[model samples]
Target: MFLQNVFTSYIFLVLGLFHVCHAQHITTSLEGRLAFPNKTPFNITTKITLNSGEYTTYSRKDGSFIIYDVPPGVHQLDIDSKAYHFGQIKIQLLEESMDSPKCLEYAYPGAPKRVVKYPLVIYAKGTYEYFETKKGVSIFGMLKNPMVLMMLFSVGMMVIMPKLMEGMDPEEKARMKQQMEAQKDPTQMFSQMFGELTGSSEDQTAAGTTRRERREQRRVKNQ
Candidate 1:
């Protein structure tokens, strides 16, 4: 019984260590083609650096390359070939497992080409991913989903509704604009809505009186 207990504890310890190691280390492939300054793809020698250290890989006949078994961290990669220009990128490793290899293409001047750059930053809490293309557009990959689209739609409606309603009569347009502005603050919106719903002219009169009294008080105080 004592030997069995010891074996069980040892097995558990080994399994725990394995799980921790699995969680800490990650492996992913980087696959992309290399192109010359003239926008022609060619076979190239690729060097990937992890954490500023020298790492090496090779591109296939089609100028495609893959780097596997990359640990979780920031990596600086360089791709070079005798026939093509050199390209460099910075990558962040965060996911426990990744299968989709990043694809990078080259761009040259005088010819419209797509240049892809992936710069990933990993934080303790999460990872931030961004990409820049030769077309002068930067994309944040994490926020490019449907939920963000819905949020943008809601905000667009909130901004455009007041302008659309402004085509009504002057008095109605002014009232709607005031209502929209008042909704910007929850406390002000609640107070105004309550006053309007209850037909409370007392609050309005009190507000006017308070303003006038404050002006008089300020004048007297200044005197």
Candidate 2:
């Protein structure tokens, strides 16, 4: 009976030591699953992380994952997926177990804590837009450029202005020549030329033509 009593005491002693060791080494795990709006092939890139990657893990074929040994503190949880985007989750953990994760977007004080359901099932809100949306070499874009507009205006003026001068009254033509010769600033001259071509300028010339050719001096408008 004494031998049996001693053996029982030894067993009890072992149990106590194990309990103490367990208490010392205890850690918490976070359980979660990734959900897709559509079927996506599981790849190495699909992963869950906590505290900006102090702890991270990948999902299984079924999209379920468990992040093990999460440090007991505040954490920002994120699911990194190239195929889709997920929402941020915030958590405050005690040493032994995980508390319900809150929606990081609404984690401000005085706001109601949005406690996420346990064994978290995070859903993909939208697919990642990885494709380039830019268009290639548009003609309208080139025509919109100021340099191109200026070049076109110069070419049209060089071809058309000679004919216009030929049909003008000698007094009006000589007055227009004097006004063009007086203009010294190239940028101001370019702006004035562009204004005249676009029909924004007044019909009266710089020399103030008193002739009936003042009506003809206005910009050639499109029918």
Candidate 3:
């Protein structure tokens, strides 16, 4: 009985030691990406704070960051970058293990909301139309002039000529042909065109004949 009691006491002592060790040692890990409001990845400096002290790290080019072996306790995590807004999180750590540690991740929310009493803006000053009571000094009068009419015609020709030339190119012709072939079915095209030319409803054509024409032809044949 004494030997069994001794072994039991030893077991309890060992268990207590194990618990104390687990409480003292902590494994902390950090993982997250730094990004701008647009969600584009960016490198940033990260700081982790514990009860004992604080440590700093930097994010990778891909914006991912990681830190390990932080003392087990409450911590404040901060991530900052010149190109993006800052991010922060609070974490608590308790024990240490060889197993994968929990990572505190962070991402910037975006530009902060603000109330602007008066947003500064600038407007260019110019008169849209200048008019004079003199014989030919009216805004509409200028458009009626031969010089202004010729200028408008020249501008229109310059804009349209390039597009017209592009359509005549062999490559454009082939591209148009391919597009037409992909979009068109001969039977459907024929049916649509015939319906339009004959002024018949699509449903009537689909049913094989117009009701009035069918009735008239049948009556004529019977007579």
Top-scoring candidate (TM-score): 2
Which stretches in model 1 have alpha-carbon errors above 4 Å? 1-15, 43-54, 80-84, 100-223
Output the lDDT of residue 223, model 2.
17
How many clashing residue pairs, candidate 3? 0
Model 2 regions more than 4 Å off: 1-29, 36-44, 51-54, 68-75, 80-86, 92-115, 123-135, 158-163, 171-223
C-alpha lDDT of all candidate models, in order = 0.59, 0.72, 0.54
Give the TM-score comparing model 3 with the true structure, all chains together.
Answer: 0.35
Candidate 2 or 1, higher TM-score:
2
For candidate 2, lDDT tens digit of each residue in 75-171? 7888877777777778777654545543343323356546677777777767778788988999999999999999999899879878999989987
Give, for candidate 3, the lowest lDDT window spanning 10 residues. 116-125
TM-scores of all predicted structures: 0.35, 0.45, 0.35
Clash count, candidate 2 = 0
Comparison by lDDT, 1 against 3, better one: 1
Clashing pairs in 3: none
> After superposing candidate 3, which stretches have Cα over 4 Å from the reference?
1-4, 23-28, 43-53, 71-73, 80-85, 93-223
For model 3, how big is the CA root-mean-square deviation? 23.6
The per-prediction tally of clashing pairs is 0, 0, 0
lDDT-based ranking? 2, 1, 3
